[model samples]
Target: MPTHLWQKSSYSAEANACLYVSTPDDATIRLRESDQPDTILTTTPTTLHALIRSAKAGQLDHLSTA
Candidate 1:
């Protein structure tokens, strides 16, 4: 896979609790932790949108240990 531009989450800082995203030419978004560039997870746009919605609705709070 070609390397796409990865952007760190706005809420991320130098301390390392950050997620990075890259939107490749296929329109699927790639997600990875800033601290682990070798590992990546890919999701389609539709699924990504749904995840964002669920997160905004607080449905994913239980998944967060922090």
Candidate 2:
């Protein structure tokens, strides 16, 4: 397994608890929460792209209580 060089989202709040993303290779995307470093999720680039697009378009706002 390649090392997951995670980077925090620029849109993340100025707190430590935020979402992180990593692409160890061209075909793989990894996501994890800063507070739960060990619990990482693997996804495809297409899926990740869709997720980001949806989030930016507020398509997932209903999932959040805030």
Candidate 3:
């Protein structure tokens, strides 16, 4: 019901592609990329944290086909 203000990561300032995230409420998180503003991904804080941890630990590298 409230407006969400998206914030770009400071690390992305010098990159052509950027990641933006917003929290419209305590239980929800929204994310979008600079190239695709209309398409958003929604998830919970816990899930997002787990995802980051996994990615950082290289647990997700094998899933990438590239």
Q: In TM-score terms, which candidate is top? A: 3
Clashes of each: 0, 0, 0
Query: What residue pairs are clashing in model 3?
Result: none
Could you give me the TM-score of model 1 versus the true structure? 0.75
Q: State the lDDT of candidate 2 residue by residue for 1-66, as single tens digits.
A: 657678998978988889999988899988898889889999999998899899999999999986
- Please list the residue runs of candidate 2 whose C-alpha ends up more than 4 Å from where it truly belongs after superposition: none
lDDT of 3: 0.90
Best by lDDT: 3
Off by over 4 Å in 3: 1-3
In order, the Cα lDDT scores of the candidates are 0.88, 0.88, 0.90
| lDDT score for candidate 2 against the true structure | 0.88
Please give, for residues 1-66, the per-residue lDDT of candidate 1 as tens digits: 776899988878878758898988677889999778889999999999999899999999999988
Model 3 alpha-carbon miss at residue 7, Å: 0.4
Query: Per-residue alpha-carbon lDDT of model 3 for 1-66, expressed as tens digits?
Result: 456799998778766679999998899999989988888899999999999999999999999988
Per-residue lDDT value at 43 in model 3: 99
